[model samples]
Target: METEPLLLSTSDGVATVVINRPARKNAVTQAMWVDLAARANILSADPDVRVIVLRGMGDDFSAGADIGEFDTLRGDATSARAYEATNSAAFAALRNCTVPVIAAIRGICFGGGFGLAAACDLRIATADAQFAVPAARLGLAYPQDAMGDIVWAAGPQMARYLTYTAGRIDARAALSAGFLLEIVEAERFDARIGEIARTIAENAPLSVRASRAAIRAALSHDAEEAALAQAAGDATFLSDDYAEGRAAFAARRTPMFKGR
Candidate 1:
């Protein structure tokens, strides 16, 4: 089915979510934010989906939040709060998803766009991709969650540079800053992205999910406790996928994971 702001399709255990407002460089609207949150919720619950790939419909990933919405937000505290909540919810959906999310970035990834990319577990960008957070230019402050996401992906120093100057960085610089997993030339971007997605899909689903959960837990402050670490390790040991993996190794054949 088609939606106004987002287009979603699922096949071969992968869900593809495309931002559809290419005429405006896919600048996100309030409605679009709601749709994104909904889509994330749906994808997260789909047993058939092992991975999610987020991308823009046309040349650019997104220009940022639609400026036209600002007028409605100005001096309206309730409206502003609601908008922020919607955006935050959308980002949270991506972060909390059981399935891994990948950002396949192309042209511009700015402001909200950058935040979205940072929320994904992996990012594959074209050589021509450009990244920025232009809150400085707009005389606005980013929310703590957004700031934390940026810091997590690119480190404090890089996050500071991007937010302070509101300058654009090329794909290579983004990779160096740890904002992207890899950068491929535009001509080869699609093939490379597909290969990565297929590789992930071919893996045992339960193992992948457990790894994602463990990584997220380890990144959180609670992970500093020895008890939590031990608990997580024990859980992994008890998982059926772990048993299947060991058995497959002994059998000298590929293992099939049923996500048990």
Candidate 2:
């Protein structure tokens, strides 16, 4: 086991979270799920973090949750629900993160791993990446908390296909289904993720966050959330970063946002 099964590193306003079990294709353990939620919550609270990227070490992103623990952790309905609750917390943390979260995927991404990717704001996978949700194969139900993300990313029909068949789909198929933002060759995968993350990090943080909030609020159809999103968007115009953006536009120079 790694000293840190999940690793976090930050630079230039982008934080990378690594699932570090390459030998097992980075399958997440129950403890790792808890750690994932904690890390996401902590990073989201950090004003310095403009973006977050989730990936795995070595060739694969993740194969999904560790099945070996199922007999103990998810052996019965009571324990299964508890286990899924932990999974839901992790998914919710990523979905609700203030900064945009990107899933940098490659190799096999299945079951819970796919759920995590679906929860992200964006997904970029290698051309050879494979995806699936194998709950049916294991004779188990998919996590309910993550269902919305899968539906939102892949649409209802595709989500049904993934869930019902438990079949593997390639990156191109996922991209066509609206699950992936883009796909790159395996060799260029890391570079592409870096480019996108940097582009987001360089943008005005307040504006980016406001946009994210607004989009989510619109989808949620909750009046309170809509109002909050409106407030956030309105606040951005009065921020120092907004002033800098306007000044830079007038000066014909790039904006340096303070995220104020």
Candidate 3:
């Protein structure tokens, strides 16, 4: 598929979606958001795709949403709603995918870029990664779902601090805030991402999908939250992979899972 603002490549059961606009520091365009969401849906439906990696082209992950598009968003209420919907759809697609999504972040990850990373199941950032949410600086309200992700990763206090300050934080600070799963030096970023992706791909797809769903549900504010955990545990216990795992352990060999 030919997408103007993004590039999609699938190989070895991993689908990599790359933000392609290097000149604007990979700032997301409206069309790009729509296309990305569509591509994500397609990948989610494909059984052969076990994982997805989101990254940016050029040196930076993303500068943020394209400021140039603000004219359309600020023009009127209808335009604003449309614009917000596009971004929300893109985020929803990422969040709702069955397969795991990893954000391989390097350099600057700001505003909408940070939102994108927050949508992923895991984030592996480079030591030099810089993060910020400048909605306050721009006098714009952060989207609720985006804010929720921040609050879920970081605490409400840290989320508020980041939003209020609109200041950049380093990779270590992000990791400390619980936003990053791992941080690696720039020299090892690519190899580290590959290793992590390979590890995820080797797992049983059914268990991974169930785990992703349960984890997201547990993060929500539902009253019966423990049900999600119970469902996840039950699903794994009932899966054929569990038996294979035990058999392999007994045989002293690695088990091959078919995701059944």
Summarize candidate 2's per-residue lDDT along 182-260 as a digit string, tens digits. Answer: 9898788888999999999999999999999998998789898899899999999899998999899999999999899
Best TM-score among the predictions, by candidate number:
2
Pairs of colliding residues, candidate 3: none
Give the candidates in order of TM-score, highest first.
Answer: 2, 3, 1
Give the top-scoring candidate (lDDT): 2
Task: Name the Cα RMSD for model 3.
Answer: 2.3
lDDT of 3 at 191: 89
**TM-scores of all candidate predictions against the true structure:** 0.91, 0.98, 0.92
Cα displacement (angstroms), candidate 3, residue 102, comes to 0.9
- Per-model RMSD to reference: 2.4, 0.8, 2.3
- Model 1: lDDT to the true structure: 0.85
Superposed by TM-score, candidate 1 places the C-alpha of residue 11 at a distance from the truth, in angstroms, of 1.7
lDDT of each: 0.85, 0.94, 0.85
